[model samples]
Target: MDNAKLQQHAIAAECFVEVPFFDLDPMHIVWHGNYVKYFEQARCELLRKIQYDYPQMKASGYYWPIVDMRLKYIKPAKFGDKLLCVATFKEFENRLKIDYVIQSASSGEKLCKGYTVQVAVTTTDFEMQLVSPPILGQQLHQFIQAQ
Candidate 1:
């Protein structure tokens, strides 16, 4: 991955999530699909940190929708496991891309890694935007520069 660019424009946030009993599968580990929910939780926190969360995105007349996502699960998380989910901003000029890491909060062991790509679209016309709107790029620029 582009670690240099990531460090240059890094925006990240972390959240704790305890694996719930309901999330476990019949085999006693968390279901694969549940990882996406955990990623969303962390992503929401990351967006809020940049002050461009879903509400703000809609209010700005653009809708940001995830167009791509990928996940690599390395370890299984069992019920009651304390997991730390981290979301990091990766790109913002053309589209929004965020990388995610979910790991054991106690051991710092990585359990999964993933990235999500979202593109901006006009809310009124539902037109896909080839490039992200200025609002997003501007906010990310100011946030990164301030950091």
Candidate 2:
């Protein structure tokens, strides 16, 4: 289904994390690279909910590798700042596209926004999959139907 249709059903996972002091730069702001870990935390939650996470993909004989990703920094987070990360499934047919939003957990200030696109490939021969594994479609259908 297209993004417009998928938005109507809306499968999203939200998670929380605090900016660790170790992730901070010399300026005491969260290092830019740390946002990707935050995004993975929420993305794992979203994937687990759909039962198509990494382990499941491996079991299904495929590896979904992240081929494209981009992030936009709206505001910088500081050490000890609490973050709320939201991951929403955007596309799952040709590739898995997940959109993310990171905001302050308390005041809800948007900090960053981005998306990742992962395409599946067979584990045995490492051939890229033109279409998603059947299990993904099945799970998505069930997820949407129940919603």
Candidate 3:
């Protein structure tokens, strides 16, 4: 499969969040670690939209937990600032990977970009998957084709 084809799997979701005071560090800006929570929120929403959220994965006899994640901070967000978080699916086959972009709603300035990779595991034996299950591939294929 081509990387370009993977881009075709892009699924996006957006959310607005206020920087709570508790998320701020001594620097008076939202702490970097909090972005992971924001990413999870958007990512979960995207997955649910496709009828394949984490619970569904487990019920389908597999567990998918993020095994890898990377984030790049382009700008800082301050307390009370509302930001837009966008999550997009970038890869789905042997692994499930999602890319995220966060931007200031008022200025449209990019605040951060990141990605998370998750691998499927058999719930019974806890074996890592080298190839995606047919259920996942079929769901993704149907979703992409319907779009």
Candidate 4:
């Protein structure tokens, strides 16, 4: 809950995705469901930077499933528009919480923002981990230490 610790331990990263024609609805704006995909792309990049991505999670004997997610749209994006999605680590204890901001890559105006929380489960027995696995803190610590 401490701001200092959160800031110090945060995993901050940004990734770019272009809105393709296929992602657009008839109105020419990106479909609402596609925003989750945008968040996923950025989340994967951030997690991969910390070696905590899906494959790594499986290798570490854990499976993390998204337990919650929310998105609020501020603007609509059209085809061929480049957007920046920034993912930041917010919490990791009983669950992993990550926040995301999607913005116009050129204008820097926020298009939407959201958060996702994932809980870990054992890969062997499929038992939910009440708290994150050891590797979570280890990777986070290493990332902070490196910074």
Candidate 4 residue-wise lDDT, 28-104, digit = tens: 89999999999999999989888789999999999999989999999999999999999998888778899999999
Per-residue C-alpha lDDT of model 1 across residues 62-104, encoded as one tens digit per residue: 9998999999999999999999999998887788889999999
TM-score, per-candidate, Cα-based: 0.94, 0.95, 0.92, 0.94
For candidate 3, give the lDDT.
Answer: 0.86
Give all candidate RMSDs, comma-separated.
Answer: 2.4, 1.2, 1.7, 1.7
Stretches off by above 4 angstroms in model 3 are 1-4
At residue 110, candidate 2 shows an lDDT of 100
Worst window of 10 by summed lDDT in candidate 1: 1-10
- Stretches off by above 4 angstroms in model 2 are 1-4
What C-alpha root-mean-square deviation, in Å, does candidate 1 show against the real structure? 2.4
Judge candidate 3 at residue 128 and give its lDDT: 92
Please give the lDDT score at residue 29 for candidate 1.
99
lDDT of 2 by residue, 10-117 (tens): 799999998888999998899999999999999999988877789988999999999999999999999889999999998888888999999999999999999999
Clash count, candidate 4:
0
How much is 3 displaced in model 3, in angstroms? 5.8
lDDT, candidate 1, at 86: 100
Candidate 3 lDDT tens digits, 81-116: 999999987877778888999999898999999999
